[model samples]
Each structure stands twice: as C-alpha cells, then as structure tokens.
Target: MQTSSTLTPPAIRHDEWALSDVHGQYSDANSHADLYRFLMRWIDVSTHLNIGYSRFGQRHLTNANFTRLIDRIARPMLELYDDSVHRHDRRLLDIGSGRGGAAIHAHQSYGLEVLGIDITPYNVERANANARRRGVWPAVSFAEGDAQDLPIPEESRALVWSIESPAHFPDKKKFLHEVYRVLKPGGVFAFSDLLAVPTRVRQWPEFYKEFLRVWDVPYLETMETYSEALWELGFDLRKTEIVTKNNIDIYTGYARRYLTYFRIPGFYKWYTGRVRRRWGANLDNVREHLRHSYNALSRGTIDYGLFWAIKR
Candidate 1:
C-alpha cells in the first residue's frame, strides 16, 4: 500500500472539507488512471483495496481465518439485504468500488448480480478483468463514476453498499443524498467508513493530521452528521455499529510491521523498484500514511463505523 497523500500537512482542521482542496497527487494523478494502479500495486488481491477487518484473538494481518473475518465485517451490512425483497432487480450497487473485491464477494457469496462504480478507469478495467478471471464477469461488472453523483438511475436499485470508500469523498452529505435518490422506496443501503471522534481528533493532530495528509482524505463525517442526514433524507437507520476494537488496532499493527520491514535498505529498494517510474509515489509518504492510519485509529482519534438503513 504505497499511498501518497496530496493534502497539505499542518492541517488546521482536516475535517473541514472543501471542493477546491482536491488537488495535487490526490485525484489529479488518479485522473490519469495510473496513480490508483501504481499506489495499490503491491496488494495481494488485484480486486482488493480496503483494509480488511480482524476479530478478537485473531491476528488480522496473519489470521488463519482472514477471509472469514473479512466476510464477518460485512455481515452487518448484508443482514439489511433482504434477498427475497430484492428479487425484482437484484443488482447490488457498490459505489466507490475500488477494484471490486466487495462486489465480486457479493456475487460469489450471495449469487447476486452486482454493479460496481469507481472513479478510476484503470480500476474499472482491472476489476472487470478480475471478474472475468473468477468467471463472474457478466454477473459482476465495474464502471467509472462518482459517488456524489451516480450514473445509476433513480429509484432503480434495491441494494447499495460502500466499503471504506466514503472517507475520500469530499461531500459525504451529498453522497448520502445521491444514495437516497437512487434506491427504490424500500431499498437497503449500507456502508463502512472512517468516522470522526471530534474531540479526540482535535486533541491529536500529531497522529491524525498526518493520516489525513498521507491518505489524501478530505475529511471524515461524524456518526451524528451521517445519522441525522439519514433520517432527514428519509431513511430509517436500522443499525450503527462501532467496530474500532476489532479493526483499527489490527490494521495499525499491519502498518507497524510494514514500517519496520521497510526500514531495511534492501527491502526498501526492492519495494520501490517494483513501482513504475512514471507513476512513482514517494515511498516515504506511503510509509507515513500507513503509519499514521494505524496510529490515529489505535489511539481513538478516529473510528471505523458500519451503518445500514432502509429507505423510508
């Protein structure tokens, strides 16, 4: 995960998001397609992008039940999906679907048709190839689109889920409105994202600010903001789960291990050499990003939240 944050450091208020602030190596390089590919090239799965979940007594980075544990993280969201009710149009819309890991998993595990929309065209192409490789091409497909303004039609989808992608979204409230606009009357919507603990975040810039800068995250919306928006947008919030205990420390530990390993000059060269020269992301930036992600998460400045609701 050689992620380079484009956000300027010394962030006075990382949570205060603005449209103009999306610059530099953030989405600019991603507009060229190669940035996303280059940044996440080392990840094991071509279709995987999200930092997966880990449970109690389970080592997240080296868990014997890694796949099952990841699936368990999504179980809360999946519970809101009524397979019977979604029979009319069974396509599960995955917004901000990076490389289609969650999308393919949905089709493979639940036998449902899935449509994944991502902002990066390269990822869309790569995700499609991955689906074909898994023999789920037609059943699971990827397209390039924005979450704030979906290309999908209004009131057409029965189920929508986003996994750990909304943190990068500049306008989470607008994204939620778009979700509400697209789903059927009783459509189920679910997502997992980094949520802010306002006071904690304000108190820990040393750990959290670097995380915002390295990850190129605009800002995180709080549980209050999102839950209130859900009701105001006409959705009945079925559940809100804070799973920091199971996830943050695990991912943080993974980064700590990588940071340690990267300290070895031989290993650093090996990893850097692997990156394409044209789209080379600063390895230092990636390390800083990864380090702070875990640090901030483990310290409680930020949290991982899963929210699922039904359209009223």
Candidate 2:
C-alpha cells in the first residue's frame, strides 16, 4: 500500500532506539557480521549482498545483498553523471549513513573526502572505528547529528548519498530541503530506499502498521511523491525508477536463508513476536497483519522503488 497517506503516529518517548540496536534485531534473522563489515567498507548495500540472488519468494540478502542492491540501483545515476570525476578533491556527505560503509568505500576506493552523519551514537562510534581500521580516519569521519538539521556548512558538499534512510526522517520534505540547502550547485544527492507503494490496501492496515512498528518510521513515500518534493526543492529530476521485482532472486534468496539458516517457520512471526516484543505489546493483530504483508509481497502486491536526483 502507498506510504504517503498511511500516516503512522509520530515517534514518542521510548520509541527512540540506537541504530545498532535496530541492526542487532534485524541481524538476528541473518547471522552475517561479515555483511556488516562489508557494508561499512562500501557504504552501499551492494557491498554487502548480491541483489541478483534470491531464494523462495523473498529477496535473500546477505550483507553482500546490500552491496548488490546498491550497485544495481546506482548504475543509472552513475551512468548519467559520474560525479566522482569532479569529486575526487571535493567533500561528500552521507546522510543517515549507517555504520559508514559507503563512506569508507568512497574514501578508500575513489579517494574522495567523505563525512557520515547519523543520530545513533553506536553507528557513529562503529563507523569511526571502522574508518580508523581502514586507515581513512582523517579522510572519512562519522558525526552525530539529526538528518533534518545537519551540522554541515552550506554549499560545502559535492555529493550527498543515503541508502534506505530518508524514510526514517519524520518530515521527508525537511530532510530533502536540508540536503538541498547544504549541497553546492550541480552537486548530486543520490539515495535508494523503501518507498511507499503507489496504492493503499485497506485490508492491509495491520501490515502497514507493523511495517511502521518494525522500523519505527512515522511515514513512507512513493517515489513519485518524493520526486515532486525534490523538484519543488530545486533538484533536477535526472532519473527515477522502481527496482521492479523483475529480479526477485534477491528476495527469494533471503527467504530461503530465513527458512534454512534460522529454521524460522515463518519470518513474520519471528520478527514481530520475537524482535518487536522488546518494544512492548505482543499484538497478535499486528503479527497476523505483517504475515499478510509478507504474503502480499510474496504474491506481488507491493514493490520497491529506487530514486536518483541532482541539484541544478
């Protein structure tokens, strides 16, 4: 169902959590620390998992799955305009950069200056540690800050990137505006995230609610809606596309892993009853609702979107 109108309740006290904690919970389904290590190294999902691979109906994503996803999603943008050519001597900021993986990749591979920002202290600490270990400490650093009000100088960044992070912002518009304000002219702001589906499925409200619960996200947006905001914010609409389930291999692979590795009879139950219980209220309704959500995706009712944009 479409995320734009879902309108989940705003996050409140105790709803706040560290990024590491969120990672730790999700990490339970897949025991892949190397995946985390890999993601931090590349700063992109593609560095962690191969999206081309799949098992069952779900995209089986190892840490490597993230890498592959990023690789595929970013191909169009990079093809249109390889900002790195001009950014070798410039600075890049990765908003909500989890564990600084892509930041590390940019610094080590392309030798571009990079800065990562996130609200989670654990992510900031871990990212810094990883950068130091990679010998990019001086060139790549992670900072603690809010996404909506980044502590960066105006017109200082040549490239801004986010991987599956903008949806976490309470006000996506504010998040975009902030990034726009900081970007220099002709700079690029590229990202890949779980966008809202185009239509709302009233029957799947529970599934929708659980989606919000699992991620603590107040809202999600369709790529179309986000594109409109980007346009209004002065971002030149370069290329926007949906990473259609044409490649379900990635998801199926993840499904197989869950069933084979974790022996989880049902991934939804394990996630909601086990992972979400820590938050409170073992809502059976939510659990069942999420099960349906899984079914919907498994049956091709929902889709993921990948978007790319640039500032004029």
The model with the greatest lDDT is 1
Rate residue 215 of model 1 by lDDT.
65
Off by over 4 Å in 2: 1-61, 73-88, 244-249, 256-296, 299-302
Q: How many clashing residue pairs, candidate 2?
A: 40
TM-score of each: 0.79, 0.69
Q: What does candidate 2 score on TM?
A: 0.69
The residue-by-residue lDDT of candidate 2 on 1-312, one tens digit each, is 546454432222124434454455334222223333322333343222223322245433345444455565546655544653444435768788766777777666555688889776667877888889878886899998888998988887777887777766777788899989998777777876666553443445545545554545566666667777889999997877666553442443334444343345576456546543453323343333334335445544334666777788
Candidate 1 lDDT, 1-312, residue by residue in tens? 311221111234456544333333334343222333444544444557665666678655432233453376456655666543765666889998776777888888777799999877767887898989999998999998899999988998988888888988877889999999999988888888887776677678768776775566777777777777899999999998887777776667667787888889998987776654644665665665666676777677788888889898
List the lowest-lDDT window of 10 residues for candidate 1: 2-11
Candidate 2 residue 136 C-alpha distance from true site, Å: 1.6
Error of 1 at 72 (Å): 3.1
| Top candidate when judged by TM-score against the true structure | 1
